[model samples]
Target: MSKIYVLDTNVLLQDPHSIFSFEENEVVIPAVVLEEVDSKKRYMDEIGRNARHVSRLIDSFRGNGKLHERIPLENGGSLRIELNHRSFQQLQDIFIEKTNDNRILAVAKNLSLEEETKEDGKTVILVSKDALVRVKADAIGLLSEDYLSDRVIENDHVYTGFLEVYTAKETIDRYYEKGEIQASEIVTFPLFPNQFLVMKDALGSSASAIGIVDKSRKKLKKLIFDYDHIWGIKPRNVQQTAAFELLLRKDLPLVTLTGKAGTGKTLLALASGLLQTEDHGAYKKLLVARPIVPVGKDIGFLPGEKEEKLRPWMQPIYDNLEYLFNVKKPGELDAILAGMGSIEVEALTYIRGRSIPDQYIIIDEAQNLTKHEVKTILTRVGEGSKIVLMGDPEQIDHPYLDAYNNGLTYVVERFKDQMIAGHVKLIKGERSGLAQLAADLL
Candidate 1:
C-alpha cells in the first residue's frame, strides 16, 4: 500500500533531494516547513546552501502541476504542498508551543486522521532528522522515522582497514625472513588494496608481523616506515602505527582516519604532512583546513581579521602543531610558522573554487561535512597533491549528521576498495587513561 510521508524542514535541509527518495508514495510538505527553510536560506553555510537548493527544487515542480494539489513525480510518487492543518488544538495538551515543529506535527496528525477514514487505510509517516520532533510525533501517537537515505554504514560495522589471519609457523617465519608473501598464500579471501594485515602464528606461538597488501605487486610486504617515532611523535599503539603507515605513504593519495578525541588522528596526519612537506620537500606546502562548526553557544561576529577570527576554531590545530614543533613559549609557534612560510591554515569555507596543487592538505573535523561538501573538497585537489580527512564520527557537531552519514565515514566506506585510498580507525586513546575509559564505557 502507498504511504503518506510528511517531510520535516530538517529532512529537506539535510538532503535537498529527499523529496524524490520515497518511491511510489505520497510526499506531503507542510507550509511551515517552507517557512523554516526560507528563514535559513540567508546563511552562508552548508545548511543554508541546502535550503536554497530545496527552494529551487520546489520551484521546479510548479511547472509540471500545482504543488498544493497532487503533482505526479518521476518516481511514481506524488508531491503535495499542504497549506491547511495548522490547527494546534489536537496537540495542545501534549505540546503548548506553536512552533514550526509543532505545526509540522499537526499536519502529520491531521493526515493520519484523514488516512484512517479512507476505505483502504494508508500509512502516514513523519520523516524528520530532529530527535525532539520525532519524540513529539511519538507522544502524539504518530509514526515517524529518520531520513536514512544518506547513511553510508552502521557504527558497529564501520571498516577498520585491517584484518587478522592465522598462518602456519613456517609460513610466518618465511614471511619474516623474506619480508613479503603472496596474498593468496596467506588468506583465501581477496584482500583490498593497501589493506593492513596482522599475520599470527597458527601454532599458538607469540610470533606475529604487520604487513600491508601491495596491489601493484600483488604481494603482502612488511611495513617499511619506522613506527616507533615520526617527526618526534611515536605511535602509542598498533592502530596508531597502522594509521601512521597510511599517512606517510606516497602511493595512497587519499587517507582517512577516524577516532575519538586524543586517538592521535589529527596529530598523526599533521606529523606526516609536516615531515613530507618540511623535511622531505615532497610537497610545496602543508595546508590545514577544517569545517567551522560551532560547539555549545556560538561566539558571534568576533572583532578581527580572518586569521585572528579563525584562531579560536583552529586552536586545536595550533595545539597539535605546538606539540610537534615543541614550541613552549608564547608567540614562539607563531614566529616559527611565519618564518617557515611552508604552512597554511585556513577555514574550509575559502577552500572552494581553487585548484590546490603539490600540497599536503589536511581537513580536520570532517565528520561535520556532508558527502557533497567532501566531494567538493576532494575535487579541488590538483595534480601531485595528497589529502587526509580525519575526524571522530561519534562526536559530530552537525545537527543533521550522525555517525553513519557524515562525510568522514562516507569516504571511508566508499574508498575501501580503491587502490589509491586507505583508511584506519584508531582504537586506542593516547590522550589519557581517563579519556580512554570514558570513550569505552561512557
Candidate 2:
C-alpha cells in the first residue's frame, strides 16, 4: 500500500528538494506549513534563502495542476498543499493553542483517520525534522518520522577519516625503510585516497608507523610535515600531525577536521594558515569565517557597525589568535590583528557572491552549515585558494542539523576519495584534563 507523507515547514526549509524524496507516494504539505515558510521569506539568512527557494519550486510545480489538487512530480510521486483537514475540533481538548504546529498536527491526525477508512490501506506519516512535532504527533496517535534522505552516514558509523591496521613486523619495517609501500599488499579492506592509516605491529609490540594513502590509492606514503612545528605550534598527537600535513600541503586545497571540542581543530588550521601566509608567503591573505549559530540565548541586537557587531560572534577566533600570539595585555590582540593586514576574520554571511583567491580560508563551526550553504562557500574558492573546514560534527547548534548530515560531515565523506581533499579526526582533547574528561564522560 502506498503511504501519505506529510511534510513540516522545517523539512522543506532543511531541504527544498525534499518534495520529490518520497517515491511513488503522495507527499502532502499542510497549508499551515506554507504560512510558516512564507513568514521566513526575508531576512537573508540560510533559512530565508531556503524559504524563497521552496516557494519558487512550488510555483514551478504549478504548471501541471493547482497546489490544492494532486500535482504530479517528476519522480512518479504526487505533491499536494493540503487546504482541508485543518479543523482543530479533534485537537481542541489536547492542544490549547492554535499555533502552526498544532495546525500541522491537525492535518496529519485528520489524514490518518481519512486514510483508515479507505480500502487501499494507505498509511499516513508526518515527516518532520522537529522532535517536539514528532512527539506531539505520537501523543495524538499519529505515525511520524524524521526526514532521512540527507543522512550521508549512520550515527555509529561516523567517518573518522582514518583507520588502524595491524600488520607483520616485516611490513612495518619495510615501509619505514623504503618510505612507501603498496597499499593492496597490506590493507585487505577498501581504502580511500588521503585516508590516514596507523600501522601497528601484529605481534603486539610498541612499534607503529603512520602514513596517508596517496591519491592513486595504490601506495601509502610517509607524512611530509608530521613532526614540524608550524607557527610555533607542535602537534600533540598523530592525528594532529596528519592534519598538519594536509593543512600545509598546497596541492590539497580542501581539508576537513572533526572531533570533540578542545582537539585543536581551529587552532591547528589557524597555525597552518599563518605559517603558510606569514612565513612561506604561499597565499596572499588568511581568511577565517564561521557561521554565527549561538549555543544558548542570543545576546540580542548589538549597537554597532558590522565589524563591531561581528566581534561577539568572532570572539572565539580572536581567542585562538591571542593564544597563538601570546598576547598578555587587554586589546593587544586587536592591535596585532590590525598590524597584520593579511589576516581577516569574517562571518560566513558576507562570503556569498564573493570569489576568494590566493588566500588560506578556514571555516570554523562548519557543523552548523547546510549542504547548500557549504556548496555556496566552496564554490567561492578561486585559483590559488585553499579552504579548510573544521568542526565537531557531534556538537552542532543548528536546529535543523545533526552530526550525520551537517556540512562538515557531508564534505568529509564526499571528498574522502577525491585527490584535492584530506581529512583527519582528532580523538584526544589537548585543551586541559578537565576538558578532555568533559568531552568523553559528560
Candidate 3:
C-alpha cells in the first residue's frame, strides 16, 4: 500500500534527492521544513549547499502543479506541500512550546488524522535523521523512521577487507614453498581484490600464514611489506600489519584505514607517506589534509593568515608529523618543514578545483565527510598521485553522519572489489590499556 512520508528538515539537508527516494508513495513537506531549510541556506558548508539544492528541487516541481496540491513526480510518486497551519493543541500537554519540531509533529499528527477519516486510510510516517525527533514522534503516537537511503552498509556488517580461512597443513606447506596458492584450493567463498587473509591449518594447529588475494593472478600471495617497522612505528597487531602493507604499496593507489582512537590509524598513514615521499622520493611531495570540523563548541574564528587560521584545526596533523620527524622544540618542526619544502599541510576546504600530481595525499578525519564531499576530493587526484583516507568511524563528529553512512565507510565498501584500492579495520587499540578499556566500555 502507498503511504505518506513527511520529511524532516534534516533529511532534506542530508540528502537533497530524498524526495524521489520513496517510490510511488506520497511525499509530504510541511511548511515549517521549508522555513528551516531557508534559514540554513545562508551558511557556508555542506548542509547549506544541500539546503539550497533542496529549495531548487522543490521550486522546479511548480510547473506540474501547485505544491500545496498533489503534483505527480517523475518516479510515479506525488509530492505536496502541507499548508495547513497546525497548532500545538494536540501535543500541548506533552510539549508546551510551539517550536519548529513541535510544529512539524503537529502537521504530521493532523495529516494522520485526516488520512484515517478517509475511505481508504494510509499510513503516515515521519522520516528524520535526528534520533530525538524520532523519539518525540513516538511519544506522540506518530509513526517515524530514520532516513537511511544513503547508508551503503550497516555498522555490524561493515567490510573489514580481511578474513580468516583454514586449509590443510599440506596446502599451507605448499603455499609457503611456492609463495602462492589458488583461492579455490582453500576457501569456497569468493574473495575481493586485495582482500587480506590469515591462512591457518584446518586442525587449528599453530601453523599459519598471512597473504592477500591477488586479483590479477587469482591467487593468494604473501604480503608485500611485512617489515619490523615502517620508520620506527611498528605494527602491534595483525590488522595493523595489513594496514601498513596496504599503505606502503605503490600498486594500491587508494587505501583506507579505520579504527578506534589511538589505534595508530593516522600515525601509520603518516609514516608510510613520509617513507615514500621523504625517504624514498617516490612522490614529488607529501600533502596532509583533513576536514576542519570542530569537536566541541566552536572557538569562533582564529585571526591571521590562512595557514595561521588553520593551525588549531590542523594541530592534530602537526602532532603526528612531529612524532614522526622527531621534532623536540616548538619551532624545530617548522624549520624541518621549511627546509624540506616537500610536506604541505592544508585544509580539505581549499583542495577543490585543483589537480594534484605525483603527491602522497593523506586525508585524515575522513569519517566526518559526506559521500559527495569525498567524491570531490578523490576526483582531484592527478596522475601518479596516491591518496590515503584514514579515520575512526566510531568517533564521527558530523551532525548528519554516522558510522555506516559516512564517506569513509562508503569508500571502503565501494572500493573493496577494485584492485587499486585496499582497506584495513584496526581492531586493537595500542595506545594504552586504559584507553583500550575506555574505547571498549565507554
Candidate 4:
C-alpha cells in the first residue's frame, strides 16, 4: 500500500510542481489549501504567480476526473481534494483557532484515523514547510514531515564554491612559477569550472598558493587581481582575492558570493561595480537591487512616495555606498548619486518588465528571494550585463525559505557547473572584531 502525503499551502507556493514530488504515493490536497491559494492568486508577486500557476494546473487535471475523487496522476500516484473537515472540531480542544493551517491539519488527521480501520491500512504523512503546523499535527498524534524536495543541498554544509587540497611543495612552486598548471597534476578529485582552490604544502611547511580552474576544468590559473586595489578597497584575504577574480572577469557573466554577515560580500561587489563601470569603462551603469521581504508587493503600508517608501529597505546599500565614497553629509552621497547617472539603486519590485543590458548588476540580501523571484530577476539580464548575487544563506527573511532552499542557495547549486557562472564563499568576516564576534557567537 502506498503512503498518503498531504501538502500544505506553502509547499505549493514555494514550488507549483510540488504536487508530483511524491511519486507512486497518494497526494492529498485539503479544500482549505485551495481556498488559501485563491486568496493569494491576486497578490501580484511571486506568491501570486505561484498561486495562479497552481490554480491552472489543478484545473487542467479536471479533464481526467472530478477533483473530489481520486484523479490518476502521470507519476503513478493519485490526487484528491479532501472536502471533509471532520477533525477540525477535535483540533479546537488543542489549537483553539480556526485558521487555515488547523483546517489542513484536521483533514490530514481525519484521513490518518480513517485509514486505521482498513486491513491494508496505508500510512499517512503530512508534508508542510511550516514548522508550527507540523507541531500541531504532532500534538494530535499525526505523522508529519517537511516538504524538502526543493532543497539544493541536503547536507548540513552547503557547497562552499572552493576547496583546500594538500599538494607537494614542489607542485605549489611549479604552479606559481608557470602561472598555470594541468589540474589533474594537482588533486585527484573532480574539478569544476571556476572552482577556487587553496593549495597548501603537505610537508608541514608554511607554503600556500591560490588558483582557480578554467571553464574547461583542465587548467588551474592564478588569481588575476591578487594585488591590485579595486576602487580603493584591496583584497583583505585570500577569499576576497578569489572573489575579485570572478568579479572583475567580464568573461563570466554570473557570479555568486555567499558568507556570514560582515564578510564584505556587498562591499566587494560594490567596489568592483564602481571600478568596472566608472574606471574601466566596461559597463554603462551600476545597478543595485534587493528584495523587500515580508512586504514584497505591499509597500503601500509605508507612508510617503515610492522613493521614500523604499528608503528603509534600501538603507543598507546606501550605507555601503557612503563608506566607499566617504561622504560626511547626510544627503551628500545622494546628491553625488543623483549627479552620477551611471549608478542606480532601486528595489527589486519593478524589475520584472525591464531588460537590463550593458550594466553591472548587484543583488544583495539575495537569500530573502524565492526561487521564482530570483529566476525572474535573472531572466532580465541582457547582453553585456554581469549580475552578481550575494547573500548569507544562513540569514533568510522569507517565511517559506530556509538556509539550503532560498534563491541564492538554489542558484549556487544549479549554476555551479555552468561555464559562464562562478561562485565564492567568504568565511572570515572583515568588517570588525565586534561584528565578527556577534556573527559567530550571537
Q: Of the candidates shown, which would achieve the greatest TM-score relative to the real structure?
A: 3
Per-residue lDDT over 309-367 for candidate 2, one digit per residue giving the tens place of the 0 to 100 score = 99999999999999899999998988888988999999998999999999999999999
Distance from true position, residue 197, model 3, in Å? 0.4
Predicted candidate 3 versus true structure: per-residue lDDT over 1-442, tens digit per residue: 9999999999999999999999999999999999999999998899999999999999999899899999999999999999984766788999988899989999999889888899999999999998999999999899999999989974579999889888899998998899999988988878899988998898988999989999773799988776888888999988899998998999989999988988999999999999999889999999999999999999998999998999999999999889988888989999999999999999999998999999999999999999999999999999999999989888999999998899999999999989899998989999899999999999
Candidate 3 global TM-score: 0.97
lDDT of 2: 0.92
Off by over 4 Å in 1: 216-218
State candidate 4's TM-score: 0.96
Q: Candidate 3's error at 357, in angstroms?
A: 0.7
Shift in Å, residue 429, candidate 1: 1.1
- For each candidate in the order shown, give its overall lDDT on alpha carbons: 0.91, 0.92, 0.92, 0.91
**What is residue 38's positional error in candidate 4, in angstroms?**
1.7
lDDT of 4 at 322: 96
- The superposed Cα distance between candidate 2 and the true structure at residue 360, in angstroms, equals 0.8
Worst 10 residues of 4 by lDDT: 292-301
